[model samples]
Structures are given as structure tokens and as C-alpha cells.
Target: MPYDYKPYAYHRPPGLTAPEPRHKVAIVGAGPIGLAMALELAQHGVPSVIVDDNDVVSVGSRAICWSKRSLEILDRIGIGARCVEKGVTWKVGRTWHRDREVFTFDLLPEDGHKMPAFVNLQQYYVEEYLIEAAQANALIDLRFRNRVKAVEQAADHAVAVIETPDGDYRLEADWLIACDGARSPVRAMLGLDFDGELFEERFLIADIEMAADFPSERWFWFEPTFHPGQSALLHKQPDNIYRIDLQLGWNTDPEEERKPERVIPRIEKVVGHRDFRLDWVSVYTFQCRRLRNFVQGRVIFVGDSAHVVSPFGARGGNGGLGDVDALGWRLAGVVRGEAPEAALAAFDRERQFGADENILNSARSTRFMSPEDGVERLFRDAVLHLANRVDFARPMVNSGRLSRPCVYPLVAPDATGLPEVSRPGAVAPDAPLADGWLLERLGVGFTVLAIGCAAPEVPGARALALPVTPELAARYLGGAGAAVYLIRPDQVVAARWTACGVEEIAAALTASREGRT
Candidate 1:
């Protein structure tokens, strides 16, 4: 089948064209976030150029876990199936104390979704898969082994001066994105302050090929038998590869702890066997940090560039992935002329919320895993034990605690007069359709969903009516409430009314097209 490549509704100015002008967006890092953003733009028929300093695709597996929300975003970009094939699905996790299971939770059953609880795939593999998916589109161009020497941002465009192996060149992009990791040069060039704390303790992440009798489940040994001061986490990866995280005692030397041979012997003491062959071992001291702002001027930071979460709950990579998914659709709108330049402000507000929330949750999880003092550890254990005892307690702990789903309150509204619909930031719920697709499937475009009512006259945009049945009514809107909801291209609830009148609908659609309320 021939590919469908639709041009953006708005075109670049014709008079100001360079001989080698290629794409509209310039992505600074070729990591997962940058790759995902490029693929997202490709789906919208908007071209982008991904520039990176690495000569080849990243090899080391810096990230090892994926959450449910990340999986859904991959599916939206049409690469979820390939990712599932390469990753190992994890549904249950065991919290071990003194080599005995204390708490075991089934993550998949908790969500009540068809998707798995989490997947353990090497970060490099995920990057490779996305890069391959990007090849199908003419919009994504990968420029590797090129260091960006300078980036000068103007109101309309960003000029990146890159130092390639051959020579120096200047590249211009309408908008620029920074997905570079923790030591972000782009952020430094912009003179942004990354304000946060760094934990003094270090940990060793060792990848090994071992024959073990342990069950294939995620295990976190909080209070372990062999180590009194340190905790251990054993996560199984693909091809009999296992990632073992051994927390270094508070005073262990970094140089001595990172040496593979030295790290292996310490791991052997805990496992009671020295049979496993170690593949790679690296010692890392993680920090709990967050950027002051996710967006500065026209340059936006995603993933590690935005925040650095300790590897306690595996939130660093997952949090970054969420940032790209949240920002991609909105940025696409600005590029396509469906939204205004001010729409970018909402990206800053929403991602800042996500970044702050993830940072706090990860900090709490880290504290629980490795409590600072006696009083803190006691409170942590008591909370978990209490949760196990009471039903209501479990819900309290699970309230936006374990990454169920994120609902944003509108900081910037796209419509007016509908107080219920104009709430600051709300993600439209995923409504399953009769045809087996989802309401999210309609997200690739500007969608106006008028539930149970005639297509209310949205003067400037496309509106899709969600047939309001008794079942649909009970699920989405209350019986007394308006069955019709206007959904924006970004899958945000725009304007909802009890009745989708022509005037109300038109006003909502016009505001969204104009990109503000």
C-alpha cells in the first residue's frame, strides 16, 4: 500500500527558502523522547530532523522499565506491537524482606486494562526499534555524530550551529526540542538552572547471564539477608539477561565499587553462588533533581533533561516518555496552524506538573526503599502494613500513587461558557467504540465529540458525534448532563454541554482553532 503523506495545513514561507532547508522541527537528542517526537510529527505529515552527537545508536541500557501510559503512546505511533515482541512483560512484583516475600502485587490486574503492567526492555533496543519505525516516513531525518556547537533562538525560528566530522554548518528549524540527557548542553547554553539535590550514596547496576531457580517476577529485596545497610533489586530482562542493582553502603568508594570484578564478588556473597557470568557492571550515584521550568523561550526540555529521578521506582525514563506524549500533540497543533503560539505555554504548565509529581513520587518510593533514619523506615513499613490490612487504605495509597492514569486540570482553556468543560486541564477518557477502536483513535485530528446529539455546528473544525446510548450515557456523562463533548486534536476535553447547540459548538470549535479561550 502506498503511504499517505499529507502536507501541513500551513506551509513555510516561500520567499525565505534555503537550498538545503529540510524540516520544520529540529530535535536535539536522538534518544527515545526525541525519536518519539519525530515519529509523532511523521504521523502528522510534519517533517523533523533529529540531531545527535553519538556516532551509532545508543548501546548501553540506561533505562529498564516502561509503564502502561508509555505503552499506549507507543501504540498510538504504531510501534507498540514491535516493542512488545522485544520486551519481557511483567505483571507481578515481589517485595522481599530477608529472602521472604512480604508484599506481592499483580500490576496488570490492578489497572483492568488489556495492556500488561510493565515491560522490561533495554533502552537501547527501544531506541533502535523507534528509529526503524521512523524510516518509513520521509519526514524524519537522522543526523548523527554531529555536535551542536551553538543554538540561537529567535521568535520564529532557532538556528543551531552544528560541528560535524566534515565541517561546521548552520541548520535552522521553526522550533527546537532538547531531549539530551542529564548533562544537557542545550540547557546549559540557554543558562537554565537545574535545581535539585544529589544523593550521596551510590549503587551498582550489573547485567548478568545466570542460571537461577528464582521465579520470573520483579523482585525488590528491601531488608535483605546478606546486606544489612544496602538493598537489592533483581529485574529479569530478555535473553536470560538480568539486571541486578546493589546499593553501595553509604561510605563505599565510587572507583572501587564500579570495577566489574570487585562488584561481582560482592554480588556473589548475596546470591550464595558465583556461577553467573557478568556482562556489564557500572556504579552510578543518582540525584533527585528537577528543572526549574520545562520550557525556556522556544526551547523545551523532555526526559532526563527536565528532571533526574533516582532509580528507586524506575521513574526517570518513564516520566520523560510521558512528557513527550503530552507535548507532541500540542506542539503539532501549533505547527499545523490548528493552534496558536500560546498553546506552547500549556505544555510548560502541564509538563511541570508531571515533572514535579513524578519527582515527589519517586522521592517517596526511594525513601521507602532506603529510609534515611529509624523513624522514617518505621513510618514506611507501618504504612504498607496498614494498607495490607484495610481496603480503604489501599485506595488511599493507590490514589495517583502508582501511575494509574493522569488527569490534567485546564490551566489554559480552549472554550468558554461551559464551566464543566472549561476546567483547567483534563485528559479525555478513552472511550471504546463499537468497531473495537477507541475514542483515542480519533485523536490524530481535531475531533469534536457531541454525545447523543446532532453534530452541533462547529464552524471551523471537524466534529464526530459519539452515539449516546444508555450505556455510553452512564459511562461518560451523567444522564442529566449533556451527552456531547468536544475533544481537541490533543485528546483534551474542550467544551461539554448538556445539549450541543449550534452556537455553543461553534464557539468552542472556533476557540480551539484559534488556540485559546
Candidate 2:
């Protein structure tokens, strides 16, 4: 018998109408954000269809690093442990000027933080895990080789025209989300402009397998001598694989290519005469652009479709994953009939705020990566030297503003006039439980914290009180006298108070659950 090597696109049988008149969310592009949104919806028992044009998982390593915040989201969906197994934790990194080492700072030792630093993992691993989990989820329909040909939004529902191997079909959904890449068709379909400054420098990211004397630690070389305009960054992944990013100066040919010999020369310049085999190499330009708006009618933009920043600060992937975490829970609520359509609007206000902050951080990182001129480089070097001498100047050397998650002010009023414990804008901080459990353990669903009182007698909420264990309490609650914090399903703070009162607690719950003041 002859072998049949036929290529055909894949598609789901057909989407059933939502059980009730629920908000149906149709996600385009089954990349990280799309898969993450599917997992989030599945956890909440909401129905969703995840469609993508690419039939197979990605081959290249696009996002090789995850921030402290991204890992927490994975934990909630029950993949955090698996992710930890495949990923390596980096607590410290060194900044360099040519061969000279500058000041080193600890990223994990900050006050009230659970994890020390970021985790370096292959982007494909994240997608692999999410895909596996989504396949097991009965509520989520994962459709591969299915592309969104067109999107039409109506007052009642948004319709997506899907192009599969079989043919094109129309899918009517209550909402359409775009997790597509930089050149987003959905964004173009809606006639939205991605407005921001663009960087002209070209860069090459190469992953290599090596067995040599290279440093196993993370290092960033600032303005190396071998290439006057080039800077090199080395990150170690699982197995003897390392991700090497080489800045290939400004004003290069668009068709300028990178040969293995050219890449090996740069690698040898940094890691003294070490033998290594290159695995994959890709060259691309960088940009710092974001869409003018995130939400248009029933459709919303997310991931690279919404914003594209220079990879200097590692904000490109991190920012998009943050969008998945933020929008997932709210979309789940709307689909589950727990919230109104108005709740979808908050996705715009919140995600746009995050996008704005991260892009600015990317711009700052770019400034440090490629300084304007010799004068700027001299000024930066002097500042670093001064940082070494002064105690307080260390933070100035390391931009504190860049490391932390951007906090958006709560627009609606909660039980307390002050911000709720894990309000929408705030990054969810860890808390303690009387049972010696970390607050993150309760992240699978919405958590309510009641302090200085008995656990609330609510049907859906689980509460904790003050005067916890000496060890566990100190580890999380930030000391015994601190107030209680109610965490949302998305791992964001919901509400907090010095003492728990039924009325105040109820108000906090109402605002988060109903999206109203």
C-alpha cells in the first residue's frame, strides 16, 4: 500500500447554541492568550471555542521568560507545578558595560513577595500545557487550522467567519476576542490604528545547545566592544539550551541575513572560545505600538494585536499574557450569567491602563539598550558608578517603576472608601490562612477574607480571621495587625477592611460581582 500524505485543515463539528441566552465569547488565534482564555473559561464552567489557523504548536521559542505575575495565573489553572518543573528560576541578574560588570540587584527579596524572580521557560511549554488542559476540558472547544476570515459585530451578537479546510462558516458569538499577533486581521477588520513610536534597530534571537564553560547565570552586556552598536543578552533554559539575543545595530538591510558563522563569531566574542551548536535563529525588527482602543462594540483586542513593544523589557509577551489573565474571569462571568454586558467595558479601562504602563517601560528599557549617543552612554555609566557608591542610588540604577506591575485606581466605590484588597487595578498580593495555606492556594475561584470576625456565613464565599498561626500569618498577612483582603477569581484583590462587617463585605462583593458601584 502507498502512503497517503494528504494535508487538510481541521475544524470542530459545530458550535452548539449556548444553553441559555449567555454571552458567547469567540476567541481568535489559539496562541498563549487564546489558550489561556479558554482555560479560564473552562475553570468557570463557561462554554467557549478556541480557534487558530496554525494546526501545530509553535516551533520557535518566542516568549522564553515569565514574570512573577504570569506564573501566578498558571498556578490558578492547575499548571503552575508543571510549569515550575520545566522552568528555571533566576533570582539575580548582572548588568555589564562591555566586559565590566556593574551593580547587581535582587529582584525577589522585595517586601511581601512570594516568588523571588522571573521564571525562564520555553513559550511552547506554556502553550503545550494550556492545550493539554483545554483538550480535557468539556466546556472548551479547541479548533486547530481554523482561521477567522471576517468579524461582524451586531448589537445582539458578534459573528465570526471561520475559514477551515472544509470551507468557510459563520459563528455567531456574544463577543469576539482577538489574541492574534502583531499583524492582526481582527484589528484591521475593525479599522483600528496601533499608535506608538517604533524602534528602527534590527535584532537576532538565536537558541543554541552548548556544553562549555559559559556562565550559567543571566547576563546583559551593555555596549560591548566587538560590535560598537550591539548589546548581547544570555538566558539559560532547561537542558543545555541558551537563548542569545544580539542587537544588530540600526540601519541594516531589510534583506540582511544572519548566517551561523556570523552568529558564532558574536557568541565567541562574549563566551571565550566555547564550542556550541546553533538550534534556531530568527531576525526581526522591534516596535512599541499599541492600539488606540482595546474594545470595539462586542469585540475586544488582546495580546500582540492590542500592543507590540520592544522585547528589551520583556514586555511583549508579559503584557499579552497579562491581558489573558485580566479578561478571562470577566468573560467567564458574563458567559455564566453572573454579570451584565456592562462588565465587558471594564476590560477596556483596565487593560488599556496596563498596556500604557508597559509600553512606557519598554521605551525606558530601549533607552538603556540603545543609548542616543556617546554622551548618553557616558551619563548612564556615571550614574551606575554613583549607584555603586551610594546606598539609595541602587534603586535608581534599577528602575523600580519598571519592575512593579502597574496599579490602576479603582473607579467604583466598594465597602471601604479605600481601595479593595485585590481590586481590579491592584496586583494580587499573597495572604495567609489559619490552616497554614497560602492565599494563592485559594485562587481557583473568588476568595473572601474576613478579619477580626467569624468567617462570613455566605454560600459561595470562604473567609479567614485574624490572629493566625505565628509562622503562617507572618509569611503572608504582613503581620497580625493587618486588615483582611478578599481576592477575586483572577487573583486580583477584591476588597479589604480593618474589621469585617457583613454590610461592607457585601458591598465589596457586589461591586466585583456585578461591575457596578
Candidate 3:
């Protein structure tokens, strides 16, 4: 079965003939991160121009797993539901050794949350949904077939030379965001380099469509009989498509391994027959690396351009979305003149912290999966052998840590009574409200979520008061009395206090904007 990769119509830009005024923000790349970043900005009433080299969504099922935190960000832009509806929802993951089950884990144990633990949706589908939703937002000006050849950053603005089908054009933007993926031209143009580890191991990744009744759970095998000594992972996706990854040692030639002849046999071994059709196949090596800083003067890097991680943990895409969430409020505030230029420093500081966390986890997973000979391999094998027998050893097995939201450390006001889930510096947890979910009630702006009490009116923030329900009490109030929470536009808790006044709340808001807190 082949995917219908439709091409988007590219409108001839006026920049080719005449000089246009400077745009507030110019985004490079139209993948998930760039599109999401553009949409997030538009939600904050900021217009952006997105320029990409290609018109079609990704050809392969590149990033298939969308974390709950990513879904929450997508929900903010009104595409979360659509993604879930078209995605395969799964929570359970099992690990096996030589056809024998060793460990099983549930991603989400409790209920009541609207989103599942994770959804397996192809990259193209997610991009198509984002592109469709973006078209409705007039603030988003998408230009396809426009590839950036060179970029120069001035003191206050950035200039890019885009080579379009018609001709080359010069576009200037106040802030140029490079979401241009792993091999970013913008980063290369700036002569910046990523500082981290690149694993020598390679894995053959493939998407197969089959009509099988496999349970919607992640199945991983360590030293599977079919692929002896190597690891294997299976995940279910929408439209009867299943994603399979087989560990091909670093010695194997990727070009030879990706051939359909070689790939077909691997699929047959995993599925037990030649009943499945290969939808997509590729070979990739893992790397856990990121830039020293996300921001560089008038130019900023987001998504893969800023950081990259192994696919094992699903951190690459989700971590990029974290960059979007952290950047949206601060960049919007800076562009809108509501916050100082120093606010972008917050985006750099917080997202850098996130990149570090992702790198640490991903690096560990990579090492566990691809250990060297001697003590490393010995310990890895021991953990797998003992994992089936003991509970403590099970935790040592690192198939993939899976993506989770990184909690940024905050120095804002707080109290001990509130639950740690909604503590300052964490994304505000979701609970069912009367009209909608707690996340739905907190609109795109600076908000004060007051539980069990009236919210204090801050100078430039919205105050949302809610009656303490059981779920709300459990998530937000804990054992404490009425409290106020200062939430940023991205639904991140900036600060919270059990007895916060207007002055304190206002100061916290300032700190959040300045990236100080």
C-alpha cells in the first residue's frame, strides 16, 4: 500500500518583484514544529511567515508517537482531537526476550484525563492536519517551494535569500526561527555546531500495513529469536499500519540494508509471512545532541535545529514541541511589546534545560541498547536476565524511557499545601471543569488560576476562578487552602502561592516575562 502524498500549491510571493515590509517572525521548515510554532504564535495574535523547501508532507512515517504533552499543545491550536481521532491510542508496553515475555508496563494507570498516554499517528497525517488548521488562521502565511539559500543576521533583523521556483527573493524578518530540522541550513549558515554524542549504532526502521489483530500495545524484544542478539520494537498505528524497528548493527551498510529485498525478508520474519506490504523503510543512526543555546541574536533555533535525540525515547518531536510551548509566550510577549527583549533569555534558559534532560535520558537509552563488549554488555545482559525474575532489575531495562514533559525549575512564590503536580514551573495539570477541562478554561494569555477563592486581578493577566471539585482539589489544592497560580500563555505554571496578593502576582508575572523566575 502506498501513501498518497499530495503536494501543496505554492503561491508566488510578492517578495520576488518588490520589497515588502519586514515580518515580525519568519519560520523555516513546515514540519510539525514549524507549523506548530507558527500556529502558536498566531493564537497569541502574532503573524508569521513560514517558508519551506518542499510542498508535500513528509514522505515516510517519520515521527509516529505523539506524547500527551504534545497533544495538549496541539489541542491549544484546535487539532488535538482530529489527531487523536485519526491516531491509534495505546498505553501498554511489553518487553520480551527470545519469544518469552519479560516485563510489561502501563504508560497511564489512572483514568479521568482526556488524552491517552500516547498516540501513534504518522508524521504526514499530523503535518496535513496542522497545515489544514494553519490555512484557517489568516496570520499564518505559508510559502512552499521556497528554500533558504543563505541567511544573514543583522543587529535587529535577519535577512534570508530564498530560492523559489520563479526566482530568488530576499525576505527580512524581525525574528527568524530556524525549525529546519536536524541538518539545519540556518545553523550551518550561522556556523553553529551541536555539542553532544552520536551513537555508532544503526537501526532499520520500517512501516508495514497489515490486517492483523495485534493488540494496541508497544511490544519490544531483547534478543528476539527472529533477529537473534539484536533488539526489536513494534508499535501499532492508524489505518492498520504497524511500525517495526530492527536493530542493524553499525557495521551493516544502510544503503544495502534499506533495499526492498532485504527489508521484505525482515518484515516476513517479524510478521511470520509475506502478508504485509512495506509502506516505508529507512536506516538511521541515533544521536543525542543539542546546540549550546537556542537563541543567537536576531536568529533563533527551534525543534530539531536546536536539539536531537534517539527515536527510542520519542524525545525528538515531543522535545521540539516543548521548545514551541516555551517559546510561544515569551516570543509573543517580546513581539507584542508587553515583555522586554530579555524575555527570550527565558526561552533559551528553560528550553536548554529541557534539551539537557532529553539528551541525558536518550544517551542512557542508547548506551543500554548498544553497549560495548566487556562489562557494559555483561551488565546489560544481566539486567535483561534478571528483569524477568526480580522487580528491581525490571527498572534497569531501558528499551526506551519514552517521552515525558520536562519540569523547568522555577524560583517563583509557592506554598507547601498544593499538590506537586501543579507546582510552580510545571504545566498546569488538566481536570474536568464545569464547562470543559481545566486546560480549556485557561485561555491563551497570562492567567491567574485561583482555586477555592477569588483570583486577584493582575495588571496584564486574566484571572480564572474555579470552585474546588474533588479532582481539582486533588490536582491543584492538595491539603492547602485557597491559592492563586500564575500561568503563562503556554499553560505553564509561572508561580503559585497559598496567600498571594495582587502586588506579588504582578511581580511574578514580570519575572516570568523576564525569564528570571
TM-score of each candidate structure, all chains considered together: 0.84, 0.88, 0.98
**Top model number, lDDT:** 3
Ranking according to TM-score, highest score first: 3, 2, 1
What C-alpha lDDT does candidate 2 achieve relative to the native structure? Answer: 0.70
RMSD of 1: 6.3
> What's the lDDT for all of these models?
0.69, 0.70, 0.91
Candidate 3 wrong stretches, greater than 4 Å: none
Clashing pairs in 2: 108-116, 421-495, 422-493, 422-494, 423-493
**lDDT tens per residue, model 3, 106-129:** 888877678889999999999999
Best by TM-score: 3
Error of 1 at 397 (Å): 8.0
C-alpha positional error of residue 345 in candidate 1 after TM-score superposition, expressed in Å: 0.5
Error of 3 at 405 (Å): 0.5
Per-residue lDDT of 58 in model 2:
65
Clashes in candidate 2: how many? 5
